[model samples]
Target: MIYTGFMFIVVGIIVLFRKIYLELQNIKIIIKIFKQQFSSTYRNNVQIKKQKHLTDLSNFIPLRSYKVYTIDQTTSLERLYMLIEKAGKTTKFSFSTYHDDESNKNYFVIDFIQPSSSIIINVEISKISHVLNDKLQELLSIIFYSSNTIYTWNYLSFPPVDFLIYDHIYSMNTDKINPKNFISLQHQFKHWYNRTFKHDENCQQIVDFVDSDGPLCSCPYRPCKFPTDTWSLSMAIMYTFHEHLQLNENPLEQCLAITKLAIIIEEGRNRQRIEALRSPSIHT
Candidate 1:
């Protein structure tokens, strides 16, 4: 009996130690993953900061300054107003116009007026697109819980008609816009903006056309001039539309895929603009 008890105690100790060891190994693996993620994030942040600093410095000392023409204020304002009016008919939303001191004097401002409990639309163009995507997802979740309509109250509203001309002038003068990729970039933006505001069946149809059928067949309008592709247009719509719907937290992989795609779109825009400026016409 004594020998048997001793044997049992020893086996119990062995089992406990094995269990502890496995738990410790799991903890170590988790720690390593966390460290790697932190390191990668830190490096990315450093690179972004450096790039922004360089851009700001370049603005001060112009090697080849490009001209940026202001948008036709009256026309831009009218277009924005019209868009809001169209969006308001289907959704319960309103618009209020506000003018900042600088914008009031310089540019037009149209506020997408909403209730106090309404979801506010905040676009952060400065941050990396990936970060912005995550932020947008979070914002949309919050908006979904609180309000039905998401309002993007513009701090500065420029007319849609003058968008191309203004971009051309800006690219030529300040080197801000890229002439070569300007058309594609604008198309991407138009699709993105439409996806954000248009959430109904018609919106989905447009999204499908732009994303899958190619740009030529994607635009529903009679004279669709913009380039729409299955990837860009559909992703934009999915990202924007999903915000208003109830979300599940389990499919983290799917969420990440969407976020990554958004980042890709943003990166493409940035690269295209820069490449356009490097073209022979700009050099001369």
Candidate 2:
């Protein structure tokens, strides 16, 4: 009887141990799930905070109010000419272009800033026949000759060559167009650190402040190295404004971004000048 009682006790102990083991396993699974949930929540929170910070930073430079007019075959060049005439002859013009691969067409965009608002003119170039018949030459003359300042992103090869390419493709006469009048923003942005605007005979005229090519902003502890090549339009915009410039095939958007970048650069330079004037070192 004692042996049988001992056997019963052993069986009961084994069953109890098995139950305890299963409960411990259940607890471990619950803890693992909790840890995964906590990690996922933490990551989500971090992403949300990062997006909020970027949004707040973007507010530093407000977007300018501008109207975009897309001109195609249906639109009248006379109407566009009237608008251009109203902007006055001396108004500065920011120019950009786009080429659509799918449609096999070209786009020309012009942005003009006004006291009240800004205007963007986007011209669609479909065919050589349409380009010649639309009196586009007269419009080109008005834009090229009327504006004292013609701002292009890269005058060296990209946009400066655009005219020549167009001429080759359409056999358009570019004799009246003067190349010396075109100003390059890429050249300007690369040399933005010199404070004292200095240019040699070979250098194109910079619109506002001139600074040498180098990294402008960084932590004081560890300054960044100077860039080797000229900054592209998108890179310059991000550097100056702390904003991402979305690049696409839309010529109108490109013009707008270019114009805004120019404005921001001027404003930043003005602020720096004001700060310099107020500093004690200036009086010293």
Highest lDDT, which number? Answer: 2
Off by over 4 Å in 1: 61-284
Q: Which candidate is the best by TM-score?
A: 2
Candidate 1 residue-wise lDDT, 143-212, digit = tens: 2223333222221332333334323432212233222211223245455444333333443344534443
TM-score, candidate number 2: 0.59
Where is the poorest 10-residue window by lDDT in model 1? 58-67
User: Runs in model 2 with CA error above 4 Å?
Assistant: 1-63, 87-90, 128-134, 157-159, 168-172, 193-224, 249-251, 264-268, 271-284
User: How does candidate 1 fare on TM-score?
Assistant: 0.22
Tens-digit lDDT string for candidate 2 (1-284): 99999999999999999999999999999999999999999999999987875574332222467777776767676765776575564367788888877888888888776655677777786553464444555566666755356778887753366777657644556665566667777776555533323333343332355333344433321122354665676655444455555555344666776676566455555434533433333411
| lDDT, model 2 | 0.61
True-vs-predicted CA distance for residue 281, candidate 2, Å: 33
What are the models' TM-scores? 0.22, 0.59
